[model samples]
Target: MTNNLSVVINSDAQQVWTMLREPARIAQWHGWNADDQEAEINEIYFGPNVVEGADHTSLVVDGGDVFTLKPVPTGTEVSVTRAAIDHNSEWAAWDEDITQGWLTFLHQLRFALERHPHGKRRTFFFSVPGTGGSAIENLGLSDVPAPGDPYSLTLPTGEEISGKVWFRSNHQVGLTVHNYAEHGEGLLIVADQPAIADVRPDGGSLAIVSTYDLGAHQLDAIRNYWDKWRAENYPTSDPVH
Candidate 1:
C-alpha cells in the first residue's frame, strides 16, 4: 500500500532537492512512460518515446507518487509518503519495479553529488537460445554492467532491452545497449556490424534507441559474438571485472 524510500546522497540536500525539482532529471532514472509525449508547453518528447536519460528538462518519472525531501547534516532524506491512487492500489503489478527504479535514482543522485556534472543510466533486456530455442529467462544479468557478472547497461538517453533475441550469424545491424552508471543517463552503444565492438559513443549524433520496444533473435547472438571477441582479446586475468 505504501513504501518508504530514502538514501544518504553524497551531495548536499540542496543539490538533491534541485535535481528533484527538475522534471527531466527525475525522468532520466525514474520516470515511467509519461515522458514520451511531445508536450505543448514543455515540448518534451514523452510517453513511449520516453528515454530514461534523454532529457529530464520536462518529466518522465512521475510514479503517481509525490515525494518530499528533507535536509540532514549527513546528506539528504528523501521520503515517498504519498502517491497516486494507482500506486496505492493492490492492482499494482510493478511493486518490484519501484524497487529497481528507486535504486537507480539514488545511484544517479550520488553520481551527481560526487561528480561536477550529473550522469544517467538506462538498461535493456532480451533473451537468446540456451541450446537452440529456449531463451534464458532472467539469467539475472539483465540489469547489470560488468560482463560475465550478470550485467546490464544504460546510456545517456534511456534504457534498451530485448527479451528474445533470434540467433543468426554475420549480419550488419546498428543497435544500442543502454548502460547504467554514474557517468550519464544512458550509454548509447551502437549495435553495428561488430556486436559489442566496444564502439565509442557519438554524443553529437541525434540517433536514439528505446529499451522497451526492442526485440530480435539476433540480439543475444550479438552479445554472444561480443563475448567471443572478449574471450579472444580481453581474456580473464584475475576474475576481477
Candidate 2:
C-alpha cells in the first residue's frame, strides 16, 4: 500500500530542513517532552539506520520511512512516504495508530515552524476510548470550518479561546488558540480513531495541546484545569504524557 502524507509549511526549504535534521529542533514538534525524549530522538533519527539524501532534500529514517522536501511558492512541502507494515513485526498491531501519529506530528511541525519558529513547546496529550461520540463535537467544534477561517468559542470548561481554524480532515481537526501561549499562539489537535480488528475494539479519541513561553505557575494552572476537565469528560481515558 502506498501511504504518503504531506504538509506545506510557511518556511523556506532550508529552515524546514534544519528542523528535520537537528535534534533540538526536532524536539519542538516531534513529540511531547519526556525524560527519555532526547535519547529516543537520537536513536530514531540519528542512529545508524538513517540516511540523508545527497542533495539534502530527502531523509530515510529507521524502518524505511522516507521524507522528501520540495520548495513551493508559499514555502516548503514536506512529504513522508510511509514504509509498509509487517504483520509479524512488534508494531503491527498499532499500524493505524502510527499513521495517525504521523499526521499529528506533521501538523505539529508546520505549526512549530510557522507560529513559533524558535520557541520550545509545552504539550498536553490524551487518548480516550470512544464513548459512541465524536471528540471534536465534545470540544464544541462539530460544525466544520474551512481552513484559515476565524473562530471563537468558550470551551466546556468555561475557557474562552479564539483563533483561526488550522485544518480539518476526515478523522482530525486542528485549531490555533490565540490565548494559549505567552504571545497568543498555540495549537490544538483533536482526532477520532476508528476501531480496528482485535485492537481498540471501541475506537478511541486523541488530543494534543501545544503551548509556548508559559511560566511555571501558569503552565501548572492550565494543566490542572485540563486535568480536571479530562477527568470529568473522559473518566475512563488514559492520558499519554
Candidate 3:
C-alpha cells in the first residue's frame, strides 16, 4: 500500500531508525506527556502488537500500520502506511481524523530530529471544534509567506513573537518561534479539520506548541494564554491540555 504519511528528516537512516525503535528516542517526538504516557507507549509500540523487521528498517504496529525508513540523498525518508479500512471496520468512522493525526506526528518527528534532536520537549496542546474559523485565521496567518521567511506578530494575548515559516500544507502550517524556549527555539503547528458530517459536525482545529528547555513560569503563562483563548473562541468544546 502507498504511504499515508511521509517526511524526510535531515538525519541519517540509522538515526531515524533509532528514534523509531527506542522508547526514549520515540518519546522525543511522539505524543505529549501524560500520566499514562509511558504505559500507552509500551502497549502500542513494544507490546504484542508490534512486529519489527530483522534489519531494523521496518516496523508494523497494531496489526496493519507500517513504519519504514530508507536512506535518501538528502537524509532519511520515513513513511507510515496505515491499514486499509472497510465500511464495517471500526476505524472507518475516524479515518480522516487519524490521517490528520499521522500528518501532525510525522512532522513532529521531522522537527525533533532536524531542530532539537536531544532536547526535552514541553508541549501545549489545544483541540477544539471549529467555529467557522481557525487558529490560523485568528493568528492572521491566512496569507503565509514562503517557508523560511521571517515573520513577527503580536498574539491576542499581547505577546510579541518573531519566527520563520517552517512548513505549510493545504490544511496546516508550522512556524519556528525564536523566543519560546531558553535557547530561543520552538515550534507551533496549526491545523484546520474539516467537518465530517455526524462525527464532527462543527469540524475542529488543533494547535500544538512545542518548546525546548523553557522555564516553568514562561510555559505556564503560555499555556494559560492559549487555554483562555480556546475557551473564549470555542466555548462549547471542552479544553484539551
Candidate 4:
C-alpha cells in the first residue's frame, strides 16, 4: 500500500525550497556529508520521468511518488507520497525500506531547519542482529517517555540529549536529539533493517547531528565514541552471503 508523511516546519516555502533543492544544504539535513547529494537529487528529481509544478511547489517522480511544498500559517508543510507497494515484486523489501527511509529523513529535515538553519551535520550509523525482541533497555533508554513526551539521557559516550520522543515502535526508536542548551537539534534513529525473507533479523542505530560551526575535530570525537560504544555493546551481525 501507499505510504506518506508530512511535517509543518517553522519556515516559509522559499527557505525550505532552498534547503531541499540545494545539494550543499541537503547534506546539512539529510545524509552523511560524504553523500553524493547533487547526483542523487538529479537522478531522482530532474530525471526524465519527473513532472514539476508550475510554481515548483511539487513534483511527481517515476512510480508515482509525489513530493510537495505547501505554505501554511506557520511555515511550509512538506510531504511525500510514495506509490503503493507491490508485494509480489522481487524488490518488495526495497519498497518498504524507501518508505521508512523517507519518513526518517523528512523529520531530520524539519529538525534541522527549525532548530539550526544552515547547520552542517555528522552522522554515525551501525547495525547488528536483534536479540529477537526490542533492545530499548539494552540501549539504556529504559526511561524513555511516551511518544511526544519530553525526555533526556546521557549516552555512554558522555554526551547528553534532551528532546521529545519523536516515535517508538516494535522495530524503531526516533528521538529529536536536542542536546541540552549547548548543541543544536539532531535526530537519533534506531531501526530494524529490512531484510528479504529467510534472512536473520538485524537492527541499526543512526545519529545525525546539526553542528553549526563545529569543525572536523568535534565530529571525529563523536564518531570515535560511537564506534567504541557499538563494539562494546552490539554483537557482531551475520556476514553477508
- Candidate 4 local accuracy as lDDT? 0.66
TM-score of 1: 0.37
The TM-score values for the models, in the order shown, are 0.37, 0.92, 0.91, 0.78
Task: For candidate 4, report its TM-score.
Answer: 0.78
lDDT of 3 at 46: 89
Tell me the lDDT of candidate 1: 0.34
| Model 3 per-residue lDDT tens digits across residues 1-241 | 2224888888998888888878888877777766777887787678887999998789997646788988889998989888887768776877777777777788889988988888888887877877647778887777878877998888775668888888877778888888677885788888988787787887888888888998789988888888787777778766657
The lDDT of each candidate is 0.34, 0.83, 0.81, 0.66
The TM-score leader among the candidates is 2
| Model 4 residue 153 lDDT score | 81
For residues 1-241, what per-residue lDDT tens digits would candidate 2 score against the true structure?
Answer: 3234789999998999899899999999997777888998898789899999998899998778888999999999998887888999988887877777777788999999998999989888877877746678887877857989999888876678889988887788889998679996899889988787676788888778898998888777767767677778888776445
The Cα error of candidate 2 at residue 56, in Å, is 0.8
TM-score of 2: 0.92
Best by lDDT: 2
Q: After superposition, how far is residue 203 of candidate 2 from its true place, in Å?
A: 1.4
lDDT of 3 at 153: 83
What is the number of backbone collisions in each predicted candidate, taken in the order shown? 51, 0, 0, 0
